[model samples]
Target: MAAPVPLHPARRAVGEALAPGELNLVGCSGGADSLALAAAASWHHRKESGPHAGTRVGAVVVDHHLHPRSVEISGQAVRQLKGLGLEPVRIVSADVDCDSRQGPEAAARTGRYAAFRKAMSELGAARVLTAHTKDDQAEQVLLGLARGSGTRSLAGIPAARGPYRRPLLELARADTEAICAHHGLTWWEDPANSDPRYLRSRLRTDVMPHLREHLSPTIADSLARTAAIAAEDAAYLESQAKEIFPTLLEDPDASGALRLQLKGLRAQPPAIRRRIVALAAVAAGAPAPSSERLQAVERLASGSRSRGPVQLEGELEVYRGARGTAEYGKLILIPPSSG
Candidate 1:
């Protein structure tokens, strides 16, 4: 017997994630990946047992309003999802806001996820699924490599995060396209996909093809494998850091300043230690801290024992003040004043 089609695993993924008496949502973008996912999730929701026994399948189309064709694309997606028996279909616009320093892609992603989270809360959905195939994972790994980011960035898109899940992460993009073809389904190809102005678009159209043609036809698979390994390593290191993080924090000051012990931080492996500092930085409401900024934090921690307090960009300050026989002092993170 031949192997089952793309929807086979796709349905199984949805079943594992959902149970009876729950609502499952698919984030559709009128693209092949999401369209295939919606179809599979709808099928699974109609199943009798195993999982998704009494679940309802719904679709949420997020319109970033970035282009003139956004509304038309969203309408087409809604009609297709409705035809596939998706329920409670609706479209929402994302309010994309970002400073000049931020790129358009990053701003758009921020807006898109915000919209998804809002929809999830309002709809009371158990989980929101987006179709991110292996192609995306590979692209992410390459992008991370180009940026020289640490292992976490190279780890690629997670299968599940918060209330969002990517059920198609293990599948290839071709599988989704095939699934659409099999069902006689039509999908939208966003013009942005081929627009060289975007890094991702260029990577998808030019770099990846060149790499596959010249270096290896299996480049995507190789990169995806690299991401999987990186993710495993990152997950394990994160768990260790979580276990050790509490040991680094000292008692809060009268003004609610939180301190992380410099000695304890220095004792940890570089990976875990860096993660803890990054976590504290984020907790203090610092914007995405770059490697240089992170290194600055580390320098202050290990620098002159008699030096004055060093201030981080997030209003967090650290100084060499003794706390319980520890003269090197602790690194304290301060939040920006609410007022």
Candidate 2:
């Protein structure tokens, strides 16, 4: 990785980082990071190529109709992109019910990503660039820790995925803001971001400051370092799992439910076995079972004579057969009725 650079340099770095055949779909949210990213990408494109066969760069702004001002802000963002000499793709808004106990932010994010992925596929986008700065990564790690999440939680946000990339992951929040300001860009300040109703807001406004004052002044940087370490460890663990997982997982339909080879699972170490089960759940899009659920599944597959089946969350069940043979199963996902 090279040293951090100015806005234009960062844009050039992103352009150079992409593969020769790759096309970019920038996610612009009218915020500092995204605005800066759009500007940087435009500058990079102008610097890298002639009018013919120039690198394809477009912008997508997802309108989550959560507030009255959301539509206006999204339009402004698209206009900003157009002003920057880029084509703006508009994604129609979606309504998500965020009244769950888990809070609205998470739900909104889930829906936003869904829409983003849909738009990417519809537009034949090769890769989607996001505006996650280093501070966001640090904040995510802290929030995950506060939730008592497992090792995966500590890994924070990923830099690259199937179609998602975060080119500004190395940049700080202040630097992103400065870049946008230096270019005379304007953005909307999400009111919900400042509302104390959200945990992340409280953490950003209160906890981080206290930590900076009392504990370590470089807490954000330290948290970012911790997230990096956790990401490395998680990657190693996933690699190990990948090597061992093939033997444990069975083929399934489009629904992704798999039958586990209980005999092979039991032979593996307890820790590895738990990870295998968790990974299976993740692959199935079902939440990972609790420790007790894992232990129950273990007992169901073991030599113990259980008269009944071991039931777990998400309708996952494990039943034992005549001679230590066991079956792990899950209910099929039923599509919504067309009525």
Best by lDDT: 1
How many clashing residue pairs appear in each of the predictions shown? 0, 0
- What is the lDDT, from 0 to 100, of the residue 171 in candidate 1? 87
Local distance difference test scores for all models: 0.81, 0.71
Clashing pairs in 1: none
Query: Could you tell me how far off, in angstroms, the CA of residue 198 lies in candidate 1 after the best superposition?
Result: 0.6
Instruction: For model 2, give the 10-residue run with minimal summed lDDT.
Output: 330-339
lDDT of 2 by residue, 1-339 (tens): 843437665675566544444456788778888888887876644335543245667778978888788878998988888888765466556556678655698788877788777777777777778888888888899888876676678889988877788888777877777777777789777787778998888887888889989999888889888888988887887677667877766776554445667677778776677677767755655577776676776666555667335555666544444544333332122111200
Q: What is the TM-score of each candidate against the true structure?
A: 0.91, 0.81
**Candidate 2 stretches greater than 4 Å from native:** 1-5, 16-19, 46-53, 100-102, 249-263, 267-270, 282-313, 320-339
